[model samples]
Target: MSNSGWTSIAETNIGTVRKVNEDDFLDLPEAQLWCVADGMGGHAKGDVASQLITKTLSDLASNAPEELSVDSICDCIKQTNYTLIELSNQHNSIVGSTVVALFFTAEHAHLIWAGDSRIYRLRSNTLERVTRDHSQVEDMIDAGLISPEEAETHPKANVITRAVGAAVELDLDVKTLPLEDGDQFLLCSDGLNKVMNDLELEHALKTMDTKTISNRLIEIALNRKARDNVTVIVVRNEKQIEEALHETLPLDDTLPLHYSNKS
Candidate 1:
């Protein structure tokens, strides 16, 4: 997707080991929204939860895109959470998913996330995570119980502390930040980050364009034998590039800088 202010793209894979792609993503640049969801539970239930989110948001985009806002999006997600919980109860099984989404408008970006699915930003040639994981190891990290490197290989690394349907009440994390001219964002499932570290992610984003960044990241994940489904969305704010071009443009000699009034 390309517009005057943003250029964005998304990609996903079942991964080398997973039989089913338990991950799904929503990309509607027309509404200036994009999301990555990682479903959990058995195939049917997991698919149900994630796809439900995708469809719900898709319908909202189609029906009232002009009305989309952070609060409105959150309201829709909360409704989906309630529906997922009811479905899980009726089926006597667990059905849940992690969600990470980005919404941009008016040179500002709003982020919403839960569980380990993440959003990161690359600004001023530096990459940093925008959303923290809602997972067991993250709790441990906060308590000073485990190093991130240790947590990566820990037995409970995959154990998430929160998801849409994990509990009756869903508390989403939200952040709003002003967008810079060269700002870029990466939203993805745990699959991609599980195999690559932050340094690797930064390196890729620093060097790759929006068109190929997602594919390159997925390829890196596959090379490392990603165990879970992977999904990646890369968005670049082209406003900075446009400004740079305008600033550096050579002035035409035909344009006069001084008047003959002095004579």
Candidate 2:
């Protein structure tokens, strides 16, 4: 559960069909923060929105206190939403993103998200989705009008009910989970989930390291001709209270961040 014992890695890809990658991610092992943003607008503008989100999160990771708090992270996201709203207004177009962020304290983790990007946890060989999609199909399923199987391929599945910058006021869902050794979390855009079911994801995460798991997930999505940008972040808490904090390492923005992206 300790911060020092945790490690994270993230990657994003344009997928096989998209001309431009509109997805972005954040991986801050030092701050124990990770995020995935799926931009929704037209090609380049979508990329702009997602990049802005990840960049804001990167700055937060740099300036964050030694101990991260839910309040601070929530405030940052609200500010980012404001910025994105202004940007959208300036362009006179819908520039928005779906965000799923994970922040950790020593013994617990907090999740915040909007739109359909998801947070999933793998523990004891089981994979469970922690975030629900804020989409029309999900609403139908909730109202008992549609079965889970029917909702997946429903025509309105991609129609998200909430998003940053889509409206002036944004709503975010938050949850907290107690931490344990070997607890692994996966945060991803809808692109990945569209192609891989819970059973497939659980099998992929069963024995691989974080890097391998991430690669395998993306590979599966691409093999399925994933229609949207794919992005993933994996966090593993290896042990509890293992050591004292070391010097704060200087992160290089010009160089590759802890996360990687593909066009």
Candidate 3:
């Protein structure tokens, strides 16, 4: 890989217990936008809610300007969240999705997320988390009421405090960092965190290719009998030499790769 371009791959699985995968993803390298949405509306409409989000993002990517910006991405997400809230109200059911998105430009890399899905970065062979979970256990950990280790297995671990449709209004968590060559970003659902510890994830990220890293993470999670859907997207930024052309990625049944603007 050179040092002037980005290469990405995405994958999602239903895991060992789930009969239907409610997770969805967007992989639009041309737009420099990638997203993962984990649905939590039971079997009948979980996929619908997740797919709806991806559809909105796809439209936004298709109409995006030649050069992308963080504000545009954030605005689109807010509109999508509002739409989701309306849909949930009409159905008289709690339909929500956890979203984690990565927006990249030549000058910056920005992460925006809600709920428990996460964004992580691998730089200089060290892995660091870029986003925090909006969950009850995370609140307890932050308030010094519980240790991180204790919170992991805490009964309230699954109780998320925020999500796209959890409320009519959503406050997104956003972080911006200077763009650097050789930097890799990983976006995943909680299923991956539930099984692969930081050390295991770091080893694979440091040793594998972008696509292989995504697959290896899912494999590791399933072998542990993950009870939730596992989804992962790996994006690597490097200088472009001969491979300036974009690459297409593969996805599972539950994970459809949506790209309105292909490079």
**Best-fitting candidate, scored by TM-score:** 1
Models 1 onward score TM values of: 0.88, 0.87, 0.86
Q: Candidate 1: list runs displaced more than 4 Å.
A: 1-3, 41-44, 239-263
**Clash counts for the predictions, in order:** 0, 0, 7
Q: What would the per-residue lDDT of candidate 3 be over residues 26-66, giving only the tens digit for each residue?
A: 98887888999999836236777777778888887787666
Rank the models by lDDT, top first.
1, 2, 3
Candidate 1 has its poorest 10 consecutive residues by lDDT at 254-263
Candidate 3 lDDT score at position 250:
31
Task: Give me the runs in candidate 3 sitting further than 4 Å from their true place.
Answer: 1-3, 41-44, 238-263
The digit string of per-residue lDDT tens for model 2 on 63-176 reads 765535787777777888898888878888888898899988868889999999999998766789989899999999999999988887789878999887788888889999
Clashing pairs in 1: none
Cα-based lDDT at residue 192, candidate 2: 90
Question: Candidate 2 or 3, higher TM-score?
Answer: 2
